[model samples]
Target chain A: MYYALQILIPLGLLMLGWGVGTLLERAHYRRIHRREDQHHHVPVTTERQLWNPDLPIAESRLVRGQVVVSVDYFKRFLAALRTLFGGEIHSYSSLLDRGRREAILRMREQFPHADVILNLRFETSTISAGGGRAMGTIEVLAYGTGVRYAQALRPPAVPDPAAD
Target chain B: MITTNIETVPGRTILEHYGIVQGSTIRAKHVGRDIAAGLKNLVGGELRGYTELLQEARDEAFSRMVDQAQEMGANAVVNVRFATSSVTSGASEILCYGTAVLVE
Candidate 1:
């Protein structure tokens, strides 16, 4: 009876700690969400300034130059392996898309009139141990230059009143 | 500083400026197999923190590369590579780097 009690006591304490930790984390997450909702805003514009070429662009900028946007999260290494066999990149779609949009919005705020940005890039990397399931973090960063396209500025046309 | 596109070799002089770009992400799951494995770790073994650490390091290195690229007046970067090394039992570092060049 004493031996059973010794084992049960430690297990119970561990479970209690895990529960409390999870509750605290959930509360923190909710507060962050509320803050983000309150801060969301964007300006509306109708001028057709964007250039549309017949051919597709090789790259596009998400934001102005010298700016960096990052998103971080954690995952288990073993779960990553399962994703490989599934062969579907969709699992990461939402995370990447949201990061891209948020970064672009921030960039627009920084460079309101800039039209063209270049040298955009994207990359990913992983670090894992050979053990069972473990916890790890993921981070996403988006960056690019912001510039006004040259064509946007041109000399105004002169009126010929004599002909009228 | 002129931006160099990573597409071509630069003229005489070892360019010192650098540009950096990077991306990172993390995910978690409660699979039965993972649960069983964690249970076994009660005896002893490393966890999955390496994945998170590597992602963070990669982002940092990419940022540095972008900075260098911008200094060199490069418009883009290419031929990127990643490397990793163990800093300690509980920590590791991952790096992502590439060549910066000029493009038309």
Candidate 2:
């Protein structure tokens, strides 16, 4: 029974971690997609100035959003294992992508009415400590100058209830 | 003081610029928060404790940079940037640097 229990326990944990991690990632992506659609009006660009050059800016200021996401144990395990083979650890791709998009979305939410966001920059860093890569945390910070036009260029849309 | 990542603060004229000024701080999570973050790694989600702690540390670094700029007789900080690195187990450094300038 001890042997059976030992095998079953690790297997059970692996299954649980994999299941929950995928589900959480999917849910986060769903929310990201919905919010991306809802926030389509606000154009976030890397350029220093508005594309139109005729918006007549009323105000602009730096807006920033930051988030720290923890890597699930299952992914960390896979990543650690992958290190031996010395190949890509695909498990972390979506996590990094999610962090960037979420941070950008949060920045957009900070100034929803802005005509455009200019000069956007993304800063990302891993917060794994000295012991090993066993513990992983990803931090992404998105910042830009959100510009508000002097005059309304488009009809004001209804507020999104999904926005927080 | 106005702080921006862009080279120049919009709608403001740069009178003079002082070279780059910077501030840094190292923060270590308490035992409780560290344990909490470890448990959170079991599931995939945001680490609220680390988020708040890092942000708090970042703000403190920013404040120190502002203080330095203020002492240099600058009213605004431009081209601001933040970087983080793990210096040791449990302790990480938050560094903020920028150009200090007088703007009108």
Candidate 3:
């Protein structure tokens, strides 16, 4: 009975993690899609220069956002199994996607007055927890210069409805 | 002081270039936060503690880089860039670098 209990406990935890993790990931993806759609007008670019070169810069500031996401036990378990086979571990992809999108959204939220974000870039790192070699959490950071063009340089378009 | 990732700050002229200035820091979370992060991993969500940890590290690196630019008698830093890497199991390094320049 003792041995059976030990097996049952870990199995139960794995199932629970799998179920809850899937639900959470789906919800996060949905939220990311909605936010991306809402902020579609806020052009994000990796180019070091602003979109309109003639536009004079009224204000420019560095804006950054970081998000740390962890993998559920079940996904980690799958990843571990994949490691043995030496194949792409698909389970971790969503974790990175969520982290990146969340970080970008947060950075955009910081600059309510900025018209666009230029030179956008992303940085990712693994944070190991519990002193284990396995990556326990993944951190994604998005940063860029938020630029607000001078009034004379403001683009002649319908003001972004989403803009405050 | 003016700081920008672009080579030149719009509407400003670069009068003198003072070469590159950089700063870096390695940081790790406390044991409590590490344990919390481990538990948080079970359900798979954002670990706020780790996020805060990296943010603090980046801020520190940025300030230190700015300080170096100031010491060089530069009023601005241009072409700024940030890099982050995991140095060890628990520790991560954040580096900020840029060219120090006197601008007007």
Best by lDDT: 3
Cα error, candidate 3, residue A140 (Å): 1.2
Predictions ranked by lDDT, top down? 3, 2, 1
Residues A110-159, model 1: lDDT tens digits: 55554443344433322233442233322333334433434554222233
Candidate 1, residue A77: the lDDT equals 26
| Residues B1-104, model 3: lDDT tens digits | 78777788766679999999999999877889877887778889888887888888988999999999999999989888899877776777899999999987
lDDT string, candidate 2, A61-143, tens digits: 67788888876778877888999999888988888888899899988998898887878998888777446454667899888
Worst 10 residues of 2 chain A by lDDT: A151-160
Assess candidate 2 and give its lDDT. 0.82
* Model 1 lDDT tens row, B1-104: 22222322222233442444433222332355345434423322222332233434555766776776776677666545445444543344555556665554
Candidate 3: residue pairs that collide: none
lDDT of 2 at A159: 49
Interface RMSD, all models, one decimal each? Answer: 11.6, 2.1, 1.7
Q: Which lDDT tens digits does candidate 3 get at residues A1-71?
A: 99999999889879988999899888988999998887766777788876576766787777788888998
TM-score for each model: 0.35, 0.85, 0.89
Best by DockQ: 3
TM-score of chain B of each: 0.50, 0.94, 0.95
